[model samples]
Target: MQPLACRSCGNTVLVAKSSLAHTSVQWADSSRCVEFALAGSLTERAVVSGCTALRASIEDAVRAGRIEVPAE
Candidate 1:
């Protein structure tokens, strides 16, 4: 899986066809994450900001070598 850097959200959210059950508040594992979509009930900017923070956290995990995600 090719990691994608979201320019608008500044996140590397995993892109796949999946359901909410397979995802989480924090997608530490790319293999488990599906693509991000803006729900009709939410604003685009809010999602973008949240995703930015999420990406930063994931980056932090990588820097600390604490993430144990399997190879995709």
Candidate 2:
């Protein structure tokens, strides 16, 4: 997993890309994510789709070759 920080909110998460369509994220602390924090509770955060900021950051990292995916 590669450590990636969200460009918008700066929360760092461990990311692993298995394929272009598959991504796994491990958050050190879900509460540390500003977007998740705004939801006010862990349950709320769980219901939330995900952090768009972090999604964008991961995409950028993949495009920039910072995160490598294995062959299909």
Candidate 3:
């Protein structure tokens, strides 16, 4: 579970891989305090923007230590 920082936005991003072919991401937003999910192929790059509310909700859950990543 290595953490990544977005170069453009400086957001904290979490990356995890499973048996499935896609990679999952958890991105953090400080303004609204939430984390957002972005999933896509491992071979391609993923970009997320313009979903502030949703991202903030997720970040809030993560900040409260409520997010659960299921076992692969």
lDDT at residue 28 of model 3 (Cα atoms): 58
Q: Which runs of model 1 end up more than 4 angstroms from their true locations? A: 1-50, 69-72
Question: Best candidate per TM-score, number?
Answer: 2
TM-scores for all predictions = 0.30, 0.90, 0.34
TM-score: the better of candidates 2 and 3:
2
- List, residue by residue over 40-72, the lDDT tens digit for candidate 2: 977788898888889989999999999998889
How would the candidate models be sorted by lDDT, starting from the highest? Answer: 2, 3, 1
lDDT of 1 by residue, 1-72 (tens): 224454445545443323322223434433322233533333543464345445555555544544434444
Candidate with better TM-score, 1 vs 3: 3
Alpha carbon lDDT at 51, candidate 3: 47
Looking at candidate 1, what is the lDDT of residue 12? 55
Clashing pairs in 1: none
Steric clashes per prediction:
0, 0, 7
Looking at candidate 1, what is the lDDT of residue 38? 39
Q: Each candidate: RMSD to true structure?
A: 11.2, 1.1, 11.8
